[model samples]
Target: MNQTAGLAVGHYILLKDPITGNPLAGNPRKIENIDVATRTVTWGTAYAPVNVTMNAVKVLFHNAAFETFGRVDSGGYLTLADQAAPEGSPANAAWLWSDGTSRALRVRTKDGITSSLNNGGTGTVAMGDTDRTPAASVHQCGVIVTTGTLTSHRLLTLPPATDTDAYGKWIDNTCTGAFSVVVRQSTGATVSVPNGAKAYVWLDSRGVTKLM
Candidate 1:
């Protein structure tokens, strides 16, 4: 039974279905091997032996990579430890997906346009001694310049956007505190804005917050 006898050059021999975790069923769909000891096999000895690999898979995680040849778990699945990485690298694990035991089948991401950045608009937020956290809509208006008078230190929490999120703000610390407007995302670290300063905040594809 020659599996590659009539197959085309670019035939995609699917070892397993990643979404459903199913193996390539039937004999015609799979090429059999004489033994499992050897990693590479040659089709014909009479002619020049073309090396064919049974399975060569490399799963990347964090700052390293792991590879295995012709190795399957009890479930007939390659069974990567349910991992993912930033599109650029495996080290950028800033934002995490759902804490699930299985890998995602598919993922979708879109760039978020703040109201101001989207339409060249501007808005003014009036700060108060009590009202420090403004609504998410206030930040959407492209560029923001804050107004208000403070008597003590205050924090202004900014809402995070979707992928590729960014906004610019001119902080007017009217309060008499050491740090007037300390900006931060709900789930991110903080960047303090002293008495008077300007900051452009951005979130990359991983949604890690940073001052741009």
Candidate 2:
């Protein structure tokens, strides 16, 4: 079996059905190994060793804008955008995607963590000056900030938990009182964030109550 040109390991090859001239069942097979000297190609454990003819097989190319296992569309392929958080289940975080309009992928926290710096604050701290509103598509994380003397307590309010399984982070910067930092969710639930402590909060859809 001779190896074909431009074919390398990890490339997916589609095996066509001989009779129907269509992709065979489970057609796309990954190239596991290639040996140029012996002229052999291996496609995992599913495919048998066969002479590599480039024209005989179809190769799938990688899409730079899309991630692996992304949704395919008529235009080409759709990258992963933000996903709805699953209730009581481990799921993937929100990801940036293209929809032809916005090329910039923006993920923001309560602070000034922007996507431009890969969400790294770079040692700079932002004040909790503005209140954040809740949206269906965005996940918000709030970090309490204290200015001047930490004598007076500051309050941080989170948006209503309208969406199921909504999650966020609350960081208390106030140094004086353990109850200095407070967080109030839309469900009338209030939590006092500990000084210099961070808490992960999520809304349990089953009970409709916010949990820390």
Candidate 3:
């Protein structure tokens, strides 16, 4: 599907007839062999020597493979060959590049704002506490659970704030089937919870994916 042409210098053009200045689409142009001893180009036909030299003529053609990564893919895309391999080939590694290496997670660009690969089933994504708002402020924090009953997950009250809307990143994941969270207080050496109060559970990643 591609055509190409190259010149080795001091050679007659292959497709142009010198006498008529017409395209040699179907005709042939003769190029005399170089005389190494005289260091000169000779012409076999009636025309004079063209006096061709390096950079004298421009090369033209379609090179689909020039943009190809190491001639591996005809299409332009970054493949394994375009990157360096890891120190050792690990069993957990997938998505191998041509360089004989692997990675657990790879971020393609520094300016890209999002992570594309999601955990297999469910996982947690948390924004920092400085950005949290309580009156349905849209930035709700939660965990994505994929296994055992959800009752075990507990949400402790957001830590008491000296500043308004203050938050913390600590979350707990140890509860069972549809239930509520509880606040516990320590009295000297003993701990107790007040009666009949609904609690909110913190969120956590269930560790269901092996991204390496």
Candidate 4:
């Protein structure tokens, strides 16, 4: 008889029933594959219910980026590291970020640095820069007017509607005018008054000279 025609249907038994001496079915479903070298058939199934196959799996090491490493909490924010300019940069030339953009910042040759902390109507700043080193400056406000001998420029602030008496005094300085006030300083110290740096004053008379 012809070998192909003489072949009979064969059944495969996967798992053996614990109680009955019968071959279990259902799982290890029917599968077929042809082996070219040995010219044989091979098939198998998952060890458990969920069958998974792996064909083109690619694992890349050192190719992953950290996400949310320094995530800000509900009432927190992200912080940036300190940065400095290379050697030889004009002492007056510093880095400043106006809004969200950074650019070359400079003070007048006659002016020093006048860093101020003022709260605009938006309660936000328009510029800032930091110098980190043996003396790490986390935050420096006001204008950086490092020009000549001075360290900063005039820090001008505006007072709230209160303090009609004090407000008038600032206007008389010729240095003060309009709805704003100017606080000039020598070093980090206030020009004349203690802690009287420039700012937009906005507190009750009982409080210290308010800085805007």
Candidate 5:
């Protein structure tokens, strides 16, 4: 359960009220330590100590630093505490978040990464002649397959990059008929990918670049 909250000053995540999204109303106790192994949280100090056992719960991250990412676990451990997902007993569940129109979870499912533009699947985007900038899911994809025939030298324009954005996609011009997809970026030079050839497009601080 994701409980959105204004970022505080530290990495301390409030243990939400079991019944409400409001911070656990009490005499404030700053968390000083977290032991993932023992599944215990310790606050206060040696003289006035406090500890509580965590039963596999997801806590909303609070702090101005996390305003962009919103929520996180393990203080950016970026690793699961347990083994694989769907552990017959433990059942490592994958988390999902939504705020922007296009964002995806990197967690793997039963089979593998899918190529669907819907449901935030990390996959491919099938484009026709008129498609300009592909969706974020397609930008995350390793390959992009076009299926349309453009009248002129198709301008495969890409979107501008932001601080939180970085992606690369392979252009596979599998469209009907023959028309070159001119991969161009606003701040960088352009590369015309032949109808039957491929080229890699990625973003850097200076903007998008193509690697043929």
Candidate 6:
């Protein structure tokens, strides 16, 4: 019974009259607290103190994307990567590089932390030395153009276990050249995005899902 309201802070919700099956008069209340486990919401006037079933509340969602890479849980809160950049340190980013020997993609974040990019499997990819982390969020999403001849295919890694509901996609930008952009799962599976193609790779409770 996943009756929890997938709402965020500062979002407005309409409170309905439980008995009449209609919105309560003057009942467009601002959401203050959400209890997912209990599927309850505590909102409305502080002086009045109203609690209601989450399913009865109508929520308005604002469209937005993450400005920083982190873990976004079911509650919609973000937990940024733990690494830190020194003052005046050059902003950095990382990339997913394919390792032929290991047959996996290795990821290195901006903070110089190196780890295997999970391929939705048991094996971990070998790490590459190149720093592929983008400097800003605006540069995060979009087509990536490679500079030189690609030795091995580059992959876009999926979010870790913490970001179970989140997914990522890579659009192959090359028009004529046969560029290989792949989505590497943590479970050791690989899905390729052909040149001039795009695919959505997401991880859910069930497993890694691909939407081409």
For candidate 5, write residues 1-212 as lDDT tens digits.
22224432224565565555555543244455555554455654222546654443446554423223343466774422322222232233333233133343344322232233344343344555664776654644566666566765776666666546666767887655566877666666666777767778776556667765
RMSD in Å for candidate 5, one decimal?
14.5
At residue 152, give the lDDT of candidate 2.
44
Clashes per model (N, Cα, C within 3 A): 5, 0, 15, 23, 1, 17
Candidate 6 segments exceeding 4 Å error: 1-41, 44-148, 161-164, 168-170, 175-179, 185-188, 205-208
Residue-level lDDT tens digits of model 3 in 1-212 = 01123433334444344456455442222345555555544333333334444323222322222332344356775443354533343333343233323332232221221122223212332312122122211112222222223323333232232233322222232333454333221111111112222223322222111111
lDDT of 3: 0.30
Q: After superposition, which runs of candidate 5 have C-alpha atoms over 4 Å from their true positions?
A: 1-127, 162-165
Q: Output the worst ten-in-a-row residue range by lDDT, candidate 6.
A: 121-130
TM-score rank order: 5, 1, 2, 6, 3, 4
Q: Which candidate leads the pack in TM-score?
A: 5
Worst 10 residues of 5 by lDDT: 82-91
- The sequence of per-residue lDDT tens digits that candidate 2 reaches over residues 92-171 is 33333333344443443333333321233111122244333323222242433332234445545455554554655545
Over the stretch 29-102, how does candidate 6's per-residue lDDT look in tens digits?
66667777776666664234466545433444334344344687899975544333323333464544444466
Q: Higher TM-score: candidate 2 or 4?
A: 2
Candidate 4: Cα lDDT at 112: 31
State the C-alpha lDDT per candidate.
0.45, 0.46, 0.30, 0.28, 0.53, 0.47
| Candidate 5 to truth, TM | 0.41
lDDT of 2: 0.46
Query: Please, what's the RMSD in Å of model 6?
Result: 15.5
lDDT of 1 by residue, 35-149 (tens): 3344332332212234445443321111212343224689887543333432452232232232134434222122222122223445566776644666555655446566766
